[model samples]
Target: MGCRQSKQKSKDSLAGAKKTGSIGNGGAAEAEFSVISAASKTCEKLGVSSKQIFGLRQSWKGIKRNMEDTGVEMFLRLFKSNSELKNMFHEFKDLTSEDDLRANEALENHATLVMTTLDDAITHIDNYDYVSEVLRKTGASHVRFEGFKSDNFLNIRDPFLEAVKITLGDRYTDNMESIYKVAITFILQTMVEGMEDALKNKAT
Candidate 1:
């Protein structure tokens, strides 16, 4: 009787497992379909084809560097207009005066973390839900981590976007609404290419 009960329980457990697996797969399929549908809608809105979006191969590292440089450039621009802000920046810079090497090391470490976080986020595009959740969480967490309010994420994005506009000049801003659409195209292309390469290597 004990053995029979154990066998029956095993069979039930297996059935439950199968059902859970099926549900998980269905959910993933739905998510994938939603992503594709959203991409299509975006392309239509931008008056561009999907092929245009997914055709370019871009370097993730280069994008992150471009973004960071843009931020630094914007900071400098803002500093020029605000003496108080310039003083604050100088004060921050002065803290490292005692040991130039140590200051350099600290700057390098911070840069590494920033780039790593951005790259990891980008590389996980195959899991869109996860990527979205992480971005939201990261944005919120940055406030506490950086000793700023949670709303700074939204505030900060505008400045960076503006910096991009300034840096790219008229070429990037010609089609105002489609700027983001074209940016997403490059991002998705890079992500898909990376994922494909990863899968091919794994299969080999």
Candidate 2:
């Protein structure tokens, strides 16, 4: 019964996705559909649809446009949940204390930047190559950080998801989760791949 219900929910979300969006059309939609269709097929190994990623992107845009300080809240949750990890960040390293978020302009700005980057990428989610390239650069940039690992990204991704859940309130759906899981997984994988490539290049 639960399985059936989940499938039905997916069906509803995909159906609603078509109606909920007014942003893409003509060649844009076709292009996105092509890219998403291929990615979704690849994601079948992971049990998610590309359409779900599209729905996730749409739902996020809705929440973000209407919410205030969500990104800020997200970073707070991130730091709170992963206190040890926070120390790795330059902004939080000199905190004088583990809990000193006050007057942390860099933390605030960096958090906002991360959230805004996500927003920008979701807007062009179909631009997979471009998105992957940018994320790769982001991962490559982290090479200089001591003890940083690809898995550490979950410390960032999970809190961001929680913040989105909170902001969406009752509007959040399982469908979005399904889609977001795929998108997030793919993103982290690409970033890690980039990091690995950077390490290899530097070693050579």
Candidate 3:
């Protein structure tokens, strides 16, 4: 019964994806369909469609061009939203001013690491299982940090999305925004799962 329900949900989600594809016509429509059809064959995990995957990879190109700025902006926004999160990083704990945070090399390096990790996930978007495992390991590694929590992983969603939006600039269309949301949600959820499992194992 549960399996049947899950399958039904997948169908519903896929059907819903078609509604967003109603943006362009003529050559653009043909091009969009071609990309979506190819992606459909390649990615069908975690309710993520081919269209979303295509959009994700394409939008990431913009982010990749300005990785440092985008990453730093993400962290900056994240820190602003939750100042105490900075305490999780020994290097950032002492920095309180926004100017100082931006200038700090350690913060920039850490930001790069975070952005690069997302790039790694995008690189293996088609292999959901492998990406999940890699993210799990990443989460597990964070267990070493005294104040780290699974929720912290989830917290990255908004700031990350904001950074991507800023980086994409004019290319950040509504459809692309939806795709990024789905991609980031998948990533954060998988990371949280991995962290929770690790934390449980550590308690044993």
Q: Which candidate is the best by TM-score?
A: 3
Which residue pairs clash within candidate 3? Answer: none
Ranking by lDDT: 3, 2, 1
How badly does each model clash, as a count of residue pairs?
A: 0, 0, 0
Please provide, for model 2 over 25-79, each residue's C-alpha lDDT reduced to its tens digit, 9 standing for 90 to 100. 4644454454545444443544645556556656887656744466766777777
Residue 35 displacement (Å), model 1: 5.8
Task: Find the 10 residues in a row with the least total lDDT in model 2.
Answer: 1-10
| TM-score of each prediction | 0.41, 0.68, 0.77
User: What pairs collide in candidate 1?
Assistant: none
How should the candidates be ordered by TM-score, best one leading? 3, 2, 1
- How well does model 1 score by local distance difference test? 0.43
> How many clashing residue pairs, candidate 2?
0
lDDT scores in order? 0.43, 0.65, 0.76
Q: Residue 68 of model 1: what lDDT?
A: 51
